[model samples]
Target: MNITVCNPLLRTPLSLIVDDSCPVINLTYYWIHQRHAWKARHQPNIAPERWEGDTIQLKKIPPTIPADFAWEWAEWCWENGVKGKFSLIPYPAGIGRVDEGFPDFPTREYQAWLRIYRELIWPSFDLTPEMLTHTAVVDLDTFTLTEAWEQVEWVDPPVDNRLTDYIIIAMEMLDNVGIPCEGVTSPGAFGKRQEAAYARAVLTASQHVNNNPRPFYFLWLKHDELPDVPIWYPDKEKGVAIASIVSCAGDWFGGWTGYDLGDADRFITEDLQGGCLPPILEKELPCVLVGHWPGFYFNGEKSGFEILKTVKARLDAYDPDGTKTLWMKNSEIGHYWMARELTKLTVMEEPPQIHLSTQFPTANFTLALDTPVRHIQVNGWDLREVHSRRDFQTDTFLVEGKQTFVAFDLEVGKTELELIVA
Candidate 1:
């Protein structure tokens, strides 16, 4: 049977291919990789007795467990059949405590890792959220080699744990080796920034990455934060939508802020769990998975083939009828290489000649790209933005104190969006 699905944003119907690619899941590792490494011995060095570190525990996993807390979360994602992968963006600030136990600089392996991130990882992932590194070992001037060894053995952090670039590298490696991957982020990169990124992504997508039919996502294409992102997507307090500068998930209540969804959220929650994703799925907008934990790294390899299992679980729940279209996660995306290799999905698209504008309180406004874009959003209400803009072109967007979604295209006529917040 021809699987022709209706495109919500485009208002057209299109045939979809076998939906092999999983919806993007940003963060897999909740606390740290140690949990997965503890007891399980994903590696020889991870044996229980050998386990020696003050690690983080998954939020839900109780402190009483005392074991590798992160593992439980990984297991949760794995069990859920969610290919929720974590990015390797390092919070060097978190290193203060980790470094206290070490004698000094990292060993040769770590040095090699540093080089890999700088040379291969960074370029590969096109990472954001800059990382800070400290690769120095301090030795006691009066201590002998044996004494130094006794006091401090080795200082080695996972390549991915130390950087987001490594996370991309690992995901890319897995994709190269036939492993399905997804990338995630917290609420940080979700809202307004995501909108701009999507705009940029669409702009880049229309170009057809390196002559490839798919899209190309340059991590740092340009900082949308250049002017200042706004909180227009979700309103948290209203039990519905609010400001969304950059948000991972758009459910105002279910999102990061932890506000209870009144009616709309209830509807979406019911839709997702009921195995009938919201009609919102019809929108062409590429939504992001926001609830991800950082610190899952890979060596261009995915061990413990659990990705498919997780994917099945989410698929079974997210799209029982197989109508919604999803995009790959950030980490799983290496210069949008995965985007190119992914199966040809049957999502609908529209001509990229429209703009979706949202107004802020004080003469401030936000805008999105669309072609003859419809303005159905209820201002000061639902955290609404353009679902998807199929018809996009190359042009500079302008923003002032309030974020503006400018749609640029070298088309027959000049297309624009102006948000006059009154």
Candidate 2:
């Protein structure tokens, strides 16, 4: 019998990536100010004409998104079982520290924002810091803002300890505010120049703060092809690995400025025939969609939020009954890819048996075998076979055509399987 590893339950993976998000402050408002300052000091020719348009857009958007909106969004995601990554900027363009409190912002309101994040957002999302501040670069030694923009200046330098230190500081700030992070989110073009060093820094910082050996980061946005979760800085002996998970689709719901109303049909048409998601689903690849927090607000109209809902509805229509697609967080997708690449499998012909050795414990690990299975026992425990894909889950097997698919909870170290076939 020929045996092969398949996707988690043999379903296409889907996830969302939200950037430029923090607790209360409308990041764009402060973000624009910092960019203007940086432009004057460093690059004086950064589109001087667009400054007025930026300021005009800022006036239309609220200074803060407020905790009420956060609660509403969190509730919607929870009800829908939506899972993804959300960024929390520790300093937020040097406006204020999340742990301490933003200057001039009401203390009570700030506390409310933190509480909403801890109770609601934390449950369904992988929370990460979009670096220390999303604006001007920070001088690690002086703890002061430099004239250079973080996205521009930071990506220029080669891999060094400073990058690791910078990431650690951001993670620590979130930790102080009672939010534990498993990864870091890059701000704009941060670390895009030297990906190897950035990957190393993320792994080192995550290990130091969260003690997470298998970490992931979000950096690039790709559209032409299905994005891959590429592993970086793997140390088998030390049990450390990191993955760069890229988003597959652009922000079609709205722009980061919270002013541009994005088209939902760009992701998935109402007919469910066209859009970027269908091709990804057809290929059974991870369709990680990208969006921004400010855009979701849409200047308080929530147009972007509505667009997301529309896209999700279209996806369901395309893969109704949840048989073809699986919604997952970026971290979960990373882990699945890691297991797919690193886990070693051994098969035996006599009496039919299989053995698996994995460095990470993964859920819903699925395998397809060419021969029909009479029974399967993982470490002496018999697995119950399910008839339908909807019924298929961990410790369950399904038979289709010449292939018999088995899904189970894969543990760390080693697992022994006794495959009794006819």
Best by lDDT: 2
- Angstrom error of the Cα, residue 196, model 2: value is 0.3
Worst 10 residues of 1 by lDDT: 14-23
List model 2 lDDT by residue over 293-404, tens digit each. 9889887899999998988888888878888888888888888888887888899889789998888667888999998888999989999988899888889999887789
Question: Cα miss at 174, model 2 (Å)?
Answer: 1.5
User: What does candidate 1 score on TM?
Assistant: 0.29
Q: Per-residue lDDT for 251 in model 1?
A: 28
Q: lDDT per residue, candidate 1, 74-143, as tens digits?
A: 4554344343223332322122211122123334433343334334333323222211111112122421
TM-score, one value per model:
0.29, 0.96
Point out the worst 10-residue segment of candidate 2 by lDDT: 47-56
lDDT of 2: 0.84
Q: In angstroms, how far off is 43's CA in candidate 1?
A: 48
The residue pairs that clash in candidate 2, if any, are: none
The alpha-carbon lDDT assigned to residue 408 of candidate 2 equals: 89
